[model samples]
Target: MPDEVIDCRGQRCPLPVIAAARRMPEVPVGTVVRVLADDPAAAVDIPAWCRMRGQEFLGSVDGPDGPAYDVRRTH
Candidate 1:
């Protein structure tokens, strides 16, 4: 489970990552951001975004709607 959840279902590439980034600063280190995305590309892009941004890609969680990207704030 994550500290905060960013629902990006139906959203494409950059939106999911962008939304997550917006809320990343709100949490402390070691906390995770759960990004719910229906876009299939998000499976790879979200983790890539986290890596490019210096965050930790904690991995994925499956939901009824879609998969969630568990990203931990490292910076």
Candidate 2:
């Protein structure tokens, strides 16, 4: 399970990624944040953000609302 869950299903593109970034600081390192995004670009955007930001992209799965990305805070 994720330490936190941010619902961005209705949001578009960078918004999902941005929302996830904004919520990251609220959780401790090593914890995972599940980002729920409906935007198809999120599948690529989230992983790219993780690679650039040094966060661990634990990958994603089909969520009730959409695809939920499992992102672990590394820094």
Top candidate (lDDT):
2
Each candidate structure's TM-score, on Cα atoms with residue i matched to residue i, is: 0.89, 0.94
Lowest-scoring 10 consecutive residues by lDDT in candidate 2?
Answer: 59-68
Which residue pairs of candidate 1 clash? none
Candidate 2, superposed: residue stretches over 4 Å from native: none
lDDT of 1 at 51: 76
Candidate 1 shows a clash count of: 0
**Model 1 CA deviation exceeding 4 Å by range:** none
lDDT of each: 0.87, 0.91
Error at 75, model 1, angstroms: 1.5
Number of clashes in every candidate structure?
0, 0
lDDT of 2 by residue, 16-74 (tens): 99998998888898999999998999999999999999899998999566789999999
